[model samples]
Target: MLGGFGTLPGKLIWPTSVTTSPDGDLVVKDSGTGHIQIYSPDGDFKQRFPYGFEPIKGMGDVTCMRSGVILVTNGTRIIQLFSKDGELIHELKSPKLTWPYSYGITVMQSNKIAVSDWTDGGKINIIGVDWRMNAILKTNAIEGFHRPVRIAVSKNEDLLVTEGQLFGRFQGCCIKVIDKNRHLKRTIGPRYGKTFSFENPSGISVDSPGNIFVTDEDRNYIVMFNPDSSLSAVIVSEGLQGPSSLSVMEHGLLAVADCYNHCVKIFRYK
Candidate 1:
């Protein structure tokens, strides 16, 4: 447990996302407060700052670029970049996006940024290193997205995006794997071993070996999938309430944004 309502420097309120800096520090984003917090590898609080103008809800995703710049989405058409110390760097917007409700975000090894736009059904837009639109993932009728939220990039640069309905019945609760050429490769969820079914697949992360980890906000646990897309294990189940986001940490550890619990949970996976 890293944060909660308290006198601590890094206290979190409704944290929705977590990522690691290149130097092995944890950077967390709280949607309830629109703030980001940094903590040392040993769970010591470092600093905190507001990532947006005001406390905004549904601002649910954050990622740290390899260059140490933090990129965050505020559920708007623009994405904000900030220094590790919480200083504003710049804002990224593509003219191609109209009324985009940005949600999930991830940066590839090639510096290509993948952001999920929730408007008009849902689609992932790939941004170039120069902050221009490179490609927007396209799907046919059979592969249309319902509501794509959190996303991850595999070792081969394939995107694994989680799609689910927000209101009403939860439909399209699965991870859609799309290749670099903007093609749907396959979907992973529902009836593999008949042991688990994803309700709301929110946060996603890929380990060094290309293993995928996902947080099921509704199911209240974390699940891991091998590179082969088979269920490797149900890694975390106890003491979780709406695990919204997760990131693979250094030295075989995992950090999860336990949303309902109002804290980040760390676990050793190896």
Candidate 2:
């Protein structure tokens, strides 16, 4: 039985990423508190993993695998693997990454890990890590990125990136899809201009049916699109204030991290 949207005792301070483990446990990255919080499927507190080698430091995104291993970024181009019991197992460092602020991470079905390195160079760095958390292959800096924030992998192993850059008083954001070989496949959303469409697209995830869902932070809604880049529908257009991250469950259930609202909203898809 599904218990409605569960609440956290303390407010989630600057929650960045939320994902489910292979056992259906909910894991959240609290950037403000610089730690990862785990919750059981029933919304009970499991445990908290501190950042750095110290306790309660700061961390970036968190991605979990089916085998119960958790991957977290330290915002310093370093990825740390933690055991199911919250013990640091392994750590991998990226020397090419000078600026910390690496925002997004996704683990493929094959257990390969991919992360987005956001820097001032205006390029997106795609780093592929092996099962041991060692950087095996990396793509050249893909230019034309203002602020690559989030990333998602499709069923076909394609990469989708969200670019969020503030322009003037407005935030210009868009999504770009890349092939497995790190080639630009297609660009979604409006072209770069004054009247651009997306406003700070922060989160992205693809459903099993090949549908893409993105959280438009400024618009306060979740936008869905077909695999071919066509708009499908707006899942939620209201009752959202600064939706940051999202995770799609198995049975058409959607979870949106409502940042300003300080809660994760669970919705059943019809």
Candidate 3:
């Protein structure tokens, strides 16, 4: 309840994404005002990155890396690297990206960054630490992605991306799992809810214990999928405007962006 309707320091207006710094500060990217606001552990506004920093005009997502540097998406075109103290360090973009925009990004311990392109059949590009665009990950249309969005990397080296939004008589949403070898492991979709299946699972994260946490945007709840492929629990099922994005901290705290509600909700998911 730290942020809600209002124009103040800690108040948030229609935030689209939430992530945590290495030391546990909450980093939120608001599309409403196009500002990246960092809050202290106790919810005090610590730093702010103003709008217009991106030549493209808005910030998309914020991912705080282990080195304390923050990687921010331009909403389209490129991802910019910024220092924890709020200085723009560098930018990560590839001349080979045909789509030009990235809505999702994840930094690996191996110094590689995974960027997602939701357009044109769905592609995830891997970039080296030196900032060279490596490879557009090899994925079969059937085995891996149909329409990909947010992506997460697990401790066991599995890359999970939200895949769905297919048209036709066959309609459903699922999480596509890829291993270290870049081979498709399996696709896990919504199956256990009593009233509805997972509708518009936009954001996903894999916990240390191999459990998966996903945000069902249309349903306004967060679903926990166990490693055994079973539904564990559903969080904030009521009063959520649009639970679209989620981030799991190193210490296991879950940060969810309640899109339409104009706030971010933090949870202790065990």
Candidate 4:
């Protein structure tokens, strides 16, 4: 466990997204407190970015680019970029993002930015490194996208998205896998029988080997998937509650934002 209630510096209230910096530091967003906490690779809290003057009310997923720039989705039409030292760089907005309430975000190996929007029928907007619109993915491209929340890009550029229900009863909880050519390849869970059904698939991440890791909030477990999208195992489920985000770190380390527990947990899955 990396953070919890204590006098320690790595305290978290409701950690939602966890990612790694270029230098191997862990960057976590505590949505409940609107604070972005930075921790060393060894799990020591280093610093936090406090947007106290302009609180981020709808903070979403956070990702770090190869250039060490951090991108954050704030549940609005725009995305925010910050320096490694937590200094705000600027906000990204475009007319192409008509009614965006951006959520899931990731930096592709090609340096493209993939962002999921929950408004106006749910879509994923791809932006270039120069911050220009590259493409937009929607149900027209695939049949299974309803409120896509989180996204992970595989080594081959395959996009794996988590479909989550924001409010009311849970309705369409599954992971939609789209190939590099924008074709729906597969849809996992929410229908994989009782054993593998996902109640609330929230966080998702891809390892160096192309294996997929997902966090089920309602089930309180982290499940692993093979490179071919086969179920490898339910790697975690003990003493967990409402795990939100997942990030595969270096040296076989996996970091999870245990939301209900108000902390981040690291595991050696390899």
Candidate 5:
């Protein structure tokens, strides 16, 4: 094994996503526990968000604000923002919001965010950092967005999303890039060949060089794409069970949320 597995002081179950805060702490959406946990760069547990709900309830993705606050998705309709010390800062929710399901989340410049949906034909929700619901990006979000499952903001500030499954069949797998206006800019998939394709892509991240890393759960691999969206290489191809999420860090450190393995895997990339 190249990357060491870490459960830290407390074991995490079914971690579906992993991200990094501005300060370099590992932020993981502890899906099985219905909470978010923070860890030091070296795999030491630091803090856990306040998760008043019981385990087995729905808890979704997580992202970090430039202010170092953590933003976590609660179910399909709520966003819980909290400080680094685990204090609740704000909750973004509305009864009238019609997003049937929530999947990916990306923090944009100027205190904006774009959240994707799980529905086959749904739009990405754009909201302000102040909890204001902004415009929903719907025009050609992507051609085959069966379930836009993960998202990341590229170095150019564009949106990168991964399609997870088609009608819950674990069939769709590809990466889509969208401009700031939500227009589809590029679709990288099997059309580029098996080496460039994915199987059940569930997580995505972009490094400073605009390199894209994606986790394909069904295939048990993480593929990398160059800044121009060309297939760069396969970071991992085996010994991984249900790799659900990934986060690209500085100095070529990559974090993988091995869902079935029940631990986080830290890998080296460059």
Candidate 6:
């Protein structure tokens, strides 16, 4: 079993993504600071990678691949690959990605990448890249999205997406589930108002048990749901200012990038 809320030193500035390395180290993308910070499981500072350039204006979102490589989205419809220690390994660019503002990225088991391009008519693209970040196989957008923010793949291979409303401000954003064939499975939430009871839903991750965890930035809480879209529980409701990205560690432990507070908070399942 995992315990809740461990203490850590150092601050993160405008952190956008949080991911755990295979070695149990917590990695984060600090957008404001233009750097990546690594932390031990116990919240000890390990190292920092400056990223060498501004990622927010150039890259929309960044994440660590399952194979331990880092993928960063370039606003110009390209993906940059970097070593875990912040070394520039390679880059992936395609003309198909114009006006790209990729806000989410996830690595599939097939070693391909599913990235969200948030543009006029938003799209989710699956791109195949080699070890050198070279493009292999590429697929077009499966569906037109309103404003896709974050993404998560279920154990059953289902793709889950959270949509953010462009107009109006309230909790009612919707979570859209799609099958492997890119077919829409169902829509969840949109319960509170036009926002679907989710205010600024950003980061999402799934546990080994097939439970889904979503960070409601405006609500300052992490919402958990079962595979059936039923409410399971609220994991962390306090000590968070703006939770952006989520990554699950071993033993049901969760790492959250609290953007506003400029710190990563770890929560354990009780």
Question: Top model by TM-score, which number?
Answer: 1
Among residues 3 or more apart in sequence or in different chains, the pairs in candidate 4 whose N, CA or C atoms overlap within 3 Å are none
lDDT value for model 3: 0.71
lDDT of each: 0.80, 0.70, 0.71, 0.80, 0.73, 0.72
Off by over 4 Å in 5: 1-9, 52-59, 131-144, 166-171, 194-196
Q: Tens-digit lDDT track for model 4 on 43-84?
A: 988998863311344447899999898888868777778889
Ranked by TM-score, the better of candidates 2 and 5 is 5
Q: Indicate the residue-level lDDT of 175 in model 5.
A: 77
- Per-model TM-score, in order, reads 0.91, 0.83, 0.85, 0.89, 0.86, 0.87
Residue-level lDDT tens digits of model 6 in 1-270: 111222232466667788887778787777766676778888877777666454344235666776677877645566778787768777777676543677788877677778876676567787666655366565657657777877788877788887765555442377888888889998777663233377667788887788888898778889888878887777778888878788888987898888777777788874
Where model 3 places Cα greater than 4 Å from the true spot, the runs are 51-59, 131-144, 164-172, 192-196, 250-252
**Tens-place lDDT digits, model 5, residues 164-254:** 7664565446778888667889888844546345667888998887888888888898888898988888889987898988887778899
Per-residue C-alpha lDDT of model 1 across residues 163-197, encoded as one tens digit per residue: 86678567778989998777988889854546788
lDDT of 4 at 234: 90
Model 1, position 85: C-alpha lDDT score? 85
List, residue by residue over 62-136, the lDDT tens digit for candidate 3: 787887888887656666777888787776555654446566778776767777765566677666555434233
Residue-wise C-alpha lDDT for candidate 2, range 83-167, written one tens digit per residue: 8788988777756654466667788765666666656634555555566535555544566666677778898888888876555
Q: TM-score for candidate 6, please give it.
A: 0.87
